[model samples]
Target: MTDDNKIVIRERSTPSKLRYASQKLIEMHDQLIDRGVDKQRATLIGIALHLESMAQAAESSAGPNLTPGFVNEPGSTSELLPAEILAAIDVPPYLSTACDTALRVEPADVPDATGWARLLHARCRLNNKFTGAPCPCTCHGREA
Candidate 1:
């Protein structure tokens, strides 16, 4: 597909939505572990889900003009959802931590059962989804 065809119109995520999504992630992780699922798979799922939520929340919170490449409907930026500023402030740190954790992993070892390994993989995927960065999704950023 051409670049135009590949373009996705993303909606900004609100702070309330972010919190709701985070809660959902915590629940998802707890349930997966509780259900005797593989820790690796469960962590991957949980992290992906959390990242998805974060993305949506970001869409809501990002100003219509936050990125120059995409177009936003007129007035969308000013008419933001009425959410607490403190809640909105969480996005940067949340994304930062997720990205940092993601960057440190070995793609091959990411699917391992160690703490947050699978989560790191999932975060990398989300990073690509959001920023269109070159993510191999194989957990091998160091070698590349």
Candidate 2:
């Protein structure tokens, strides 16, 4: 704990703690699913999205540090980390169809591309609809 009475978690290797957290999140996910939310979306939002937000908040509060950052180099060029993520996944049919239509249309097809871009980043974390609908980390642009 710090002067502000906040518990600070430093990064370290702890397999048992990680397992415990995972189990607890899974139990919470099951409880949430029982309440009527879709199982896939429930797990994604409850466990994955929440954890990601926590990680982002922790890193943000840590401020600039001499040690290298997690996702990128200490200093790197500007590029869409999120966009690059798209190429790595086997995109679902719904998203691929949307992409196909977008490619055929003119740039002026929609008035506010920027607005749509932000929204897409905020919400559309496409789960893998093929096997298990696991959460893809597409919601990185969310305001933390």
Candidate 3:
């Protein structure tokens, strides 16, 4: 596209890192086209290579050990979910006992059924139907 046709993507004043990456992609595409690559293939290859480079940059910039548990993230950026919900979905033997007992416990038994309460709260938040209204579980509005 020409300068006049170039689309301006303004999102919170375009993050510097993102703008740099986008400009690099444009440069790569132009360079490949100059070297006689077909426009479609040049654009595709440029975008793919740029994405791989960005992912590698992010991975190397991240310091320390790989994260533990389900996410295996390098940092604390992963979404935190309740252990109760995790176990409930997988039904691990150890936590299954807790789940069974917790599930049977009354919702009013907050301390005793903390795990169950967490599972219910997580369910309410993650599922769209429940997000519109106050959760009917013990842990609802408690995250604050």
Candidate 4:
């Protein structure tokens, strides 16, 4: 086929774990708002927005293939109370710690990788362990 006659197809990029988690939180936020329970819980929406921005920033900085190593499922909220849903999707603390760890890692450790790449790899290494877990480098909370 001639180049002009052939169709070009572009594959969609999969979202990183951070993006996925942000989406879940947004979903919960919408549901809570729908039921008139947003009140103090409305922060979920803001957090989700921040996470989306962070995901974009990470992608731009690390390359388009950045993916964190955590799994976040929103599960079935139909049977749960709004408070329960809030508790269920309370991921910022873990993510914050992970981000902190990612940002604080020494550039020398990852050699030629960019800041976002270091974050991505560190999150992967920490995988599903974002809950107050110490960074593998033993430098969680320490400034780089």
Candidate 5:
């Protein structure tokens, strides 16, 4: 408790809290699956997208200090930081594929020329699929 009517923080965020949050998210995932939303890839994509958004918001609120370029010397060529530019990179190809899967579009619908990129990311071909692409159809993408 504090004079400002807010609880005073005495400890830093711990791994236990992170674990609990992860577990709760997993439980919510299970519940979603039970509700006929069984697309694991798509679910993961959605979660990743949500997390990235949250990270961007945090980075923005923390201002210039959060990026690697903020510490550049006085004579730097540009104001934009390289790290910030990298952070704005588009969603990964596999993640995009997952989004497409969740949206009920065939893999062919996404023409980003990253077919082999999925393999590099180690996100494809986990179970019973010839290519690195998993069975996106199993994840409610067709009927959603």
Candidate 6:
């Protein structure tokens, strides 16, 4: 078949990290139910699974518009869902605290290493800020 007439199907080479984590939670829930663990434990896992699904949906809807910074910006989506989900699942306090701490970091505090700069660079490229070339931002070492 000619290239224009041939059909093609492309699939993701691997599931997203969040999807894998959700699958693991499902496996844990199944194991708990099969082993006759307490109903409350299984119920908590179910809640976690639901929360993961919600997060996935939100992420999908946000798509390329999602910014990668702390939830400090007004009108931006809160980055605390992961921490809240951890708390709901009754994980150790330290783990939840760590999640909260990580999400609360200010991008300006670590501009070079933070996702905020990468996102800005991407926007710059998309806007052809450098004449249809990669952004010359210092974040990527171009000295702009």
In candidate 3, clashing pairs total 0
The C-alpha local distance difference test score for the whole of candidate 4 amounts to 0.47
* Top lDDT prediction, candidate number: 1
lDDT of 5 by residue, 69-137 (tens): 453221233343355554666522233344444344334455322432332233322222111222333
lDDT of each: 0.47, 0.41, 0.42, 0.47, 0.39, 0.41
Given candidate 2, what's the lDDT at residue 123? 40
Write the residue-wise lDDT of candidate 3 on 21-118 in tens digits: 56666676667668976545434444544454445445444544343232322222244456675555643222222233434664564432553433
Query: How accurate locally is residue 42 in candidate 3, as Cα lDDT from 0 to 100?
Result: 37
Q: How large is the C-alpha RMSD of every model relative to the true structure? A: 13.9, 14.7, 19.6, 19.1, 15.2, 18.9
Clashes in model 5: which pairs? 39-139, 125-132
The TM-score values for the models, in the order shown, are 0.34, 0.25, 0.25, 0.32, 0.25, 0.27
Off by over 4 Å in 3: 1-14, 37-77, 91-144
Better candidate number, 1 or 3, judged by TM-score: 1
User: Which has the greatest TM-score?
Assistant: 1
Q: Which stretches of candidate 6 lie over 4 Å from their true place?
A: 1-15, 43-47, 64-144
Expressed as tens digits, the lDDT of each residue in 43-65 for candidate 4 is: 56556655765666555545532
| Candidate 1 structure quality by residue, lDDT tens digits, 1-144 | 344633222345455555555556566666767897765555545655665655554664464534554433221333333457535554331233344565565344543434565555544433332322343334544422
The residue pairs in collision within model 2 are none
Residue pairs in collision within model 3: none
Task: List model 6 lDDT by residue over 41-114, tens digit each.
Answer: 53445444544544555565555434444322222335434545545563321212222333444244652234
Q: Would you give me the overall lDDT of model 1? A: 0.47
* lDDT per residue (tens digit) for residues 19-108 in model 2: 445455666566766796653533333444434444554554456434334332212332224645666777554432223333334244
For candidate 2, the TM-score is 0.25
Worst 10 residues of 2 by lDDT: 71-80
